[model samples]
Target: MSEQEMFLLPPERPTISHLRMFLSDLAMQYHSLATAALNGDYHTSHTPFFTANGNIVGSTRLRALIHKFNTEFSDYMRGKGEKLKLVHSRFADPLIRSPESIFSLKKKKKASQAKHAGWNGYAIP
Candidate 1:
């Protein structure tokens, strides 16, 4: 079956332990993806969250998760005086700019200058 269909398929009767395990795995995956996005690993044309055509992948699952969390999880947490907020939105760019390319460019320029400077083991004095 296609990946989309797989995602859409509801899980069979799951025990509490199975549900907990599934949620834990899902949380970890979300954390990893969020971290990558924050570190500028994803670009506009390429992101696991969106298809090449700009449609959100597994959107139904995403919506259901968000709805359940907002309603059930948030309420449960709030009773304990804990605050949890989940914002659903799309970002046009990464959270931070990647500096590795800039650093590499500067290194290359310095190396080029050094190669062209001075004489063999001596300065032009």
Candidate 2:
């Protein structure tokens, strides 16, 4: 009935059911991504959500989703304030670090070492 619909071959036409299914799948994938990211499993959680129908989703849409979710997470963390510490600080964390601490690379003496140094204090010349 619409101009776009009229231009399509009958077999090529996408039905409402097809769009609904695609959105449903997207919602499920987004939910999975959110939950896994919250659980700190970001590396593994993102792989399946980044693809659909055996193909990677377009970069523009993927970037929007990543940005949107990251912003939401940042906001939530800001709102929660110290509440997140109750969940995460229970165990000693490898990220517990400070300048002058061995695990802390904040003082980049090693990076500044002539063995690895280059232009403008960056590795790149």
For candidate 2, lDDT tens digit of each residue in 20-86? Answer: 8878988998787767655545346375554554455534244556778999999998887563232
Question: Could you tell me how far off, in angstroms, the CA of residue 62 lies in candidate 2 after the best superposition?
Answer: 17
Worst 10 residues of 2 by lDDT: 81-90
Quantify how close model 1 is to the true structure by its C-alpha RMSD in Å. 22.0
Worst 10 residues of 1 by lDDT: 92-101
The local distance difference test score of each candidate is 0.62, 0.60
Q: Output the lDDT of residue 45, model 1.
A: 31
| lDDT for each residue of candidate 1 in 23-110, tens digit (9 for 90 to 100) | 8988988787766555555544336463434555444234445676789877886686534333344762343234565567789999
Candidate of highest lDDT: 1
